[model samples]
Target chain A: MSDVRAEAIELRDAVVLYGAHPALTGASVRIGRGEIVLVEGANGSGKSTLLRACAGLKPLVRGEGRVLGFDLRHERAEVRRRTALLAHRDGLWADLTALENVQVWARLAGAAPDEAAAALGRMGIAGPLASRRVGSMSAGQKRRCALACVVVRRAEVWLLDEPHSALDAQGRDDLDALLVAARAAGATVVVASHDTERVAAFADRRIVLSGGRVA
Target chain B: MTEPLATARTIAAKDLAVERRSRVVANQVLPFAGLVMVMFAFALDDDAIASRVAGGLVWLAALLALLVTVQRSFAVDAADGALEAIRAAGADMRGVFLGKVAALAVQLLVLEAVLVAAAIVLYRVSVRDPLLLVAVLVAATAGLAAVGCIYGGVVAGAGGRETLLPLLLMPVAAPVLIGATRATESAFASGGATPAEGWPWVGLLAAFAAVFLVAGAMSFAALVEE
Candidate 1:
């Protein structure tokens, strides 16, 4: 968005292992800032694994990476602080009001309360709905709330796994618009999903995974 | 740069708020603590329990309640990846550790108070040195909460964290239990200001707390990552 194309993510032969098994195998990928990339693969094919690695949620077994200029190996915390990862789990506290979930996270990230409320409004969750516990909400609503957290965080990069799973048509469209808007605001977006048809309209690149490597 | 305590305070607020809303401690752990203490009363009769085991019973009940509350704290956070959100925010994992310890400590303190009240009422345990008892209560519960929170994180995602936590925590907690019970016994013997007599045990509790607090804070980021 700033007319600056910088390397936002750089992974060089990065290996990620879970116990004795390898989840990602020497996969190398580069993504520039302000870009929206879709990671596509079947279950256990390392789509989520790669996103987590980039999020600093998972460790690399071998090779190297740098996220937003921080070494993935040594300064993973710095990368994590700058990114938001919406994993398969919605990550919202079921007992907390939807608004509390967003605001607490926003405040934790040092964002203003107004920004949290605005993020909730952007996700179509305000008023009474915002005060309701997340456990009582529908699956789609929970996903939306989680998305609100990601948005409210104001992080530099967003790593989402199957963000469209439970959303309806309208929700899906809202997400597409939100992702595009986020990119326009200069945030890099990497969404892992198999349903490329739904997100391809806004995705700048489509990277496929096979056998843990970027195929 | 954000204030270090800012995120920790936010985390503590969120956790405490959730507990308040859910009443998990009120409806579940408090009752569990009461039930355990009540059963202790039933098992040993009034005289045998009151004179011999009141302090140990209270300590044991608080420990059980601490175990449950600590695990529950992590469970709620881990439920929807809230823990991961905290981590990814890079919002001072040490704060995350301290925040959780603070929440669990508060809940455990409440449980201790309830257990103490129950001990006084049910067991007729006289308070000669309520001061020493109170000191042992606070220091030992702090140690228990800190240790429980750390192990709670360690087993957060494990296959059998539920069972693993107690085994891992209780042994480490034995010193706290022993020191607390011994100190309380001494205070009961000496009466007011008798806590000075058990200062050595109190020191042990404080040392245990410092060890685990530092360890938990340092390692929490790694524990929750997986």
Candidate 2:
């Protein structure tokens, strides 16, 4: 154990499985505050499994991990509160406008309006589009709405899976800026991306998953 | 307590907003109740029979209102991705359930009043005691929403919800409907069976509400995450 003083996420020989097959086997990683970590692997290679475990979405089938000092097995809710998980599902109300989506999440995450709006606006997602129904928005724009959800939340850790999949060049640039800012503000951000070009640009460190363990 | 209440309020407000946007309660429920009332009028063609049974008719309308509304309330959450969002947001499912129950309770109350009023007008029925009627409405609506919220959460993730929802719900809600209608009829007949005589059934309804509310909260986490 290399005792890092400000470790945000620490997974120790953690194993997670879906039914019979193990997704993560003896996987161990430590992420420190203010670090931008990238998790990369092929499909079915446990990238998402690791991210889901770290975010407290899926329980570890074996071993131990701690998020924000809350044991993954015991203090699940505590870990969930301090971390935000954004998956392929935008998790926004399609009937709700972008601002309403952010506002709903902000309240759920116990964030203030001014802070949330500033976070969304900083990413250049603002104005009338904020109030337009997400169902009415384009794919890239909906992705931006999901991004705004993460920014508005006051979590110290973010587990994002393929956040840049549908974004355009400007959208990617904006996301990169947001990730950098999130890291700069002492939030441990773990992004799972198959896109090497984008990961190379913003990732502070990269962990590659082969088989079911970190390669 | 404050956070849980705030979370509950937020959940309630979000559901209300969606309902408002789509005019689900106002548009879908009112017309559905009206249709049921018209059907009940034709189903019981005897004016004397209809007048004598107006309370049960209205209570039946309320149950159908619950059937129509609770499923859609949860379906809306599932459709709008609100359920997944709430889970991802770390909300207490109990609070979320209570919030949904609260919203549904209010909507059910409004719909129940509509049913009661529409039944009175359409069937030319008279009320012996209005306040007692409202009390029955409150107790019955609470029970309905509580049970319906759980079934709603259950069916929210299942396939063929249209077929599964009623199949799962009717058996569970049958007791509530029987108890509510019996309580309402006894009260309306000016019989000695006061709301107190019906207290046991009311207590059953309240206890049932408590059980479902807790179960809804605990099970909600698993359901939404699924």
Candidate 3:
């Protein structure tokens, strides 16, 4: 495979701005295919922005980027189709049950309902919990449901921001297992989180961001 | 079904399902519209004047309720970053726009039915032609929903979306209000008007609906993305 195809994510001098302030200032990064990479940063350090840039949710104002061989600036929709980003917000319909939320996302991703239910089951949300409305679920439960959504997406690239926050011990372990399984299956994973000790053992490499640049 | 059409159907169905569970339209918006009609009845105490102005009053109430319904519709998606998630999932943006418009149109149609019933009873107005009235309702609702979705998406996640939506939507929706009111007036045959006079206005409403729907679908991706 060519170098571009060998690397799951490649960024060169990428700059992403929120208004006039630069969230990612001329940052460059590379992660090989099937690698589990952890991105560490302090508050306002642009960790989330880096993950979003890889997911094609944020546009690069000044540099070149490619995820899974699709150019970030020109092929954002293609990148988005092959990647999933789990951010701080659960991204769920509050009025719908957990099962319904995952099913809707599954259908949107062209996955079967059975796959959605199985994802939820893997996240430890089953039976009554799956049937309960997301609005009433505890924060950790909601996070698990959101993870279920990420699971059902079946993307080639996983861009997760703070994937561990709001999860119980079991949920955290489940998430870690999920990440390991994803890497084993050849899905590249980029996670931005402050909880390094938890992810350090399994992460293939670690990169830190300071003031929007790789440090 | 084609992928885009199927995606649109799923989005529309999901929206309707959320609305059903939340009951925001049924419990809140519908009651608010009914109250507006009631207030109009009280303000225009004279039966003849109320009947004559019923068409304008009904459409006016719908316009105000359109603002509320659209706000509620977008709020559901904005509340938990659902729209962002869907967009990042690479679901078709045009499909998303159409689904939202379809859901909003369905809710607005139901609201219009209630408003018309309230108008007939409260204003003591008689319908000259039911078919004309139905055409006016469908076309007018489509225009309202299309415009509402466009402006709603524009302000979906903004800090001042509540006030911003009305400010952005009301001025642009003036044509819809005028067209619907005039067409409805003819439908009721008030002031010596006839159903034939409303057909042209229905055409205008449909045109407005088509233009806004196309524009909204094409621009929805940019509007929702950062």
Best by TM-score: 3
| Candidate 1 residue-wise lDDT, A8-121, digit = tens | 999999999867889999899999998999999889999988998998878887999888888788888788888889988888899988999888878887788888778988
lDDT (Cα, tens digit) per residue for candidate 3, span B60-135: 9999999999999889998999988987888898898899899989999999999999999999988998999999
lDDT, candidate 2, A4-69, per-residue tens? 364788888899986588999889888877789999989999998888788787788788999877
Better of 1 and 3 by TM-score: 3
lDDT of 1: 0.84
lDDT per model vs. reference: 0.84, 0.79, 0.91
TM-scores of the candidates, chain A only: 0.96, 0.93, 0.97
- C-alpha lDDT of residue B148 in model 1: 86
For model 2 the interface RMSD, in Å, equals 2.4
Candidate 1 or 3, higher lDDT?
3
Task: Enumerate residue pairs that collide in model 1.
Answer: A91-B80
Provide per-model DockQ scores: 0.73, 0.51, 0.66
| Per-prediction interface RMSD in Å | 1.5, 2.4, 2.2
Q: What lDDT does candidate 2 reach at residue B113?
A: 80
Give lDDT: candidate 3, residue B14: 95
Off by over 4 Å in 1: A1-6, B1-3, B46-49, B190-196
* Candidate 2 residue runs with Cα over 4 Å from true position: A1-6, B190-204, B214-219, B222-226
Colliding residue pairs in candidate 2:
none
Error of 1 at A31 (Å): 1.1
